[model samples]
Target: MHWKEYIKRMPLEVKQITGPLVLGEGPHWDDRVQALYFVSIHEKTIHKYNPASGEHTKTTLDGRPGFIVPVEGALDQFLVGLEREFVVLQWDGAEGSAVKFVRKIGEVDQDATKNRINDGKADPRGRIFGGTMGDEKSPGDFAQEQGSLYRVDGNITRVADKIGISNGLAWDLSAKAMYYIDSLEQNVRRYDYDVDTGDISNMRHIFNFPKNGLDGFPDGGTIDTDGNLWIAVFNNGVVIQVSPEGKLLRQIPIPAKQVTSCTFGGPNLDILFVTTSHYMNKPGEGDPQDGCTFMVTGLGVKGHPNVNFKF
Candidate 1:
């Protein structure tokens, strides 16, 4: 609402498929395959949909594909989240899929009400980083700030010492800056990221949403071509476009109540692909559009290509 460069948008194309996904979120566009990849947390599946042809494929993975990053030279290799563990999946087209356990989570008992894998992304240098929440079975763990952010190299994974639901994660073009959101705290943070070493430090809050009668939190988000942050507003039925400096640009309204994550795709990256939820919708105040996929066209916005899994 503060930046003149941004504008409101309508959901150009809204599609509600049969998968009554528990919590539909995390959207990644695969340029090579000309498809969009996303996941539903409660259902524990990865969905592949070709935007051009509307062809959809469902892959029930071992753990939830909290997020996805392609393999550099291999059409099969993909880095994804499997519950609290991080796995490298090899998609063999018609041959089905193969998975390698890259990082194994410890036996930390999370509050069934509070612990789940939340959001993530790969650094330009190819290391994997993701946020965690109390799994669907353990939500109490996060309400108490038990879940934290994590990082993994080849074999070792480091748990961030302190933080609440590590929700949003994205990388800038240079890979030198990383954008993040601390959901419970209601703020977006930035850090000096080292692509070569996969080290993140110098944390600072760049954006903090106003408690302006909004019902939800700023969940998952991505950095745009102009370095602005496009964040999905959970429970608010909208997405907020914020400048790198944390100034509100525009509020793109949708018909859903629980908007989870968003990403920029399309040939020129002008389209914004968004995912949503209906889990916590109150009765009588519901919008049927919840749990559906909405497309935002003519955003004139472009996003950075997701970093591929180097291993």
Candidate 2:
């Protein structure tokens, strides 16, 4: 079937859940707790939403949170990318619960004060693959190639360096291939992954934005059960679905621009939860739904369970 025809048959329903954030990023669904978790980077806050009860709560953090992932065997504990350091966060998800910084597991870019962690995800085996980006005070203006990608398990290992804007990560169901995005490059790269050792090699570009006629930089992404990638495009107001072979399968238009990240959530894991940013936009300039977290449903697909850090 033609890509457009296939997409036309798929019914889509999008709804805004949480909103008006300052740079909302990183949406992770905790199946164990049946809740959705995400962070607003510039706001330095972590948010949790319970769909069953329609309850939304946020906890302010001391530093910018690039991403958050649940820790294995501990529901209240999470590993967060806090500025330049990877810290263990303890929060009970209670209303106005006090948050605690348990300890710092690892730190990156010690000499580069301007760099901070960006997007991250855990491999099927529970090892974290996180990356950082250089000082980016404004859109399209950042220190190029000052960031690096690191694999965190027992130790921190720099798997790749010279990154422009580290964003989006996903491992295939078989754990044999990894998909990554560096927004500045406007492309998605595939890597041969080793699940046992947390190593990646043989990197190759799988998707190019301009070549495919896509408008904005590719931001955060997640993989469906079919191994297709759903990527949020910054400044494009769309989430695109790309086949494993790098074919443009579908373009899911969002109501707001500055779409940052997305993840599969909900009881059946068929819902795609997306996050957007309000960075640099004046109050009356952009869409009212800007910086809101949205839920895209009825795609007729499901995603794997959220991976947790082994630590």
Candidate 3:
């Protein structure tokens, strides 16, 4: 099929799942349960939505939850990146049961009053790697760059420092390259990664967003089967796909202005689940679909299975 014909039949219409969340972010899919998991930062709640049955359930957490990933070797558990630390969450009973905090696995900072874990993902090796951002104020009155990236295996260790709004984190198919986004700098960077040791070096710029084109910065993202990075442009009202070599592919339009994050879900791993935020919109300026979880299909692409969090 021709390019235009392919685009015409792509089925870009997105179906809204749940809505009006304070700051909906971090979409993850669990193949075992056939459910989608995400977090609402300000609300401090973790949402579990079953796309097949349209059953949505949320559990309140003590602090702001940034991201959640499935736990390796344990089908009924998950690893949550909270504002101050990483904790294990166990399902109360079965697939739709409530979740409860199991234990604090690792912490980002001892102070825990300023910075919080923002976004993260598990590497191919099952170690959960995430980053922190200055939420309330800078740590010890430091600059905004005080935020840092951390790798949480059995303990939390700082991977890199001087980060601002740590967002998208993904590894290439080879597991030798890692792609990261620090929204403050407006650039997605590529780093040489040591898959076995979880070390990253040789940082280089991959793609930088235009200073004025998009309304907001880049947020969370995931890699497709083709190795293209699909990034949620916060205020641009779309998700942009870029090739590994830093070439633009296409834009997937979103109804919400502040798109927060996205991941692949559904049984076939062909559905793109998108999360949006309404905190940036005025009382009546937000779209009807704003702050809702959206599902996009017929994209002609599939996503790799999510990596489990290694203990």
Candidate 4:
């Protein structure tokens, strides 16, 4: 079926949660705290929102944050990809609270000073998997193939290389498959995953954006309980849902032009929280909701809970 038909059948109810950031990305829902955490990379800030109370709070950081994930045992501590380093951060989510850096877990691309960590997540076993992107000369222009993907399990190990704008990642536990996206490639690759040892192999392209008549590159992604992948398409203003077999199932339109990433949240994990970017928007240009975080509902699916970083 065509994407337009899918949109017609599914009338998604989207609501803006919080707004007008420089670049809003990396969304994670903490079920334990019943709150949502996300980052605005260029603004150097981390935001927390409680759905129940409609309270939004944020703390500024010294460096740009790529992603934020909760720590397994520490409720108040988190593992953040800050610039090129993976560091432990402690923030109590209080308004006007200060964020303390505990220690640096590791750093990537030390030699490539221009490269920085981009997007990341923890595997089912609690190992942190993150990727880096080369220098961004301008919007949609980057130093190609100077980045790599890394697995952090106490020690940082390079899993894949020759990446340009390394982006989305999702894992299917039942199928032992890992889905990855290098945004510049405009395609999604599936790898044979080894859950026990945190290994991935036998990579093959599963979904191609241009070939499938899609407009933008694939960005951050999350998996549903049924193993379907919901991918955010950067510059496309929509998120596409693909089946395990690589077939497009639906396309949900977003108001913001630069939709960066998305994840499922809410009490039942049924709400899709989308993050947008205002990276290249000039003063008084583009939509007013360009850098807002939106909550999408009415989709009949539940997502797996986010995995916390063990160390």
Q: For candidate 3, write residues 233-275 as lDDT tens digits.
A: 9888999888989887889998888898999878878789999
Candidate 3 Cα outliers beyond 4 Å, as residue runs: 1-10, 93-99, 137-143, 211-215
lDDT of 2 by residue, 199-277 (tens): 8899999999999998889999999988999999999999999998999999999998999999998998888999999
Candidate 2: residue pairs that collide: none
Question: If ranked by lDDT, best first, what sequence of candidates would result?
Answer: 4, 2, 3, 1
For model 4, how does the per-residue alpha-carbon lDDT over 218-272 read when each residue is reduced to its tens digit? 9998999989999999888999999989999999999998999999999988889
Model 1, span 211-281: residue lDDT tens: 44455788988878788889999867888888877788878887787888888776766678888887675
lDDT of 1 at 129: 76
Worst-scoring 10-residue span by lDDT in model 4:
2-11
What is residue 109's positional error in candidate 2, in angstroms? 0.5
Candidate 1 local lDDT, residue 18:
32
* Preferred candidate (lDDT higher): 2 or 4: 4
Clashing residue pair totals per candidate (backbone < 3 A): 18, 0, 1, 0
Location of the lowest summed lDDT over 10 successive residues in candidate 1: 2-11
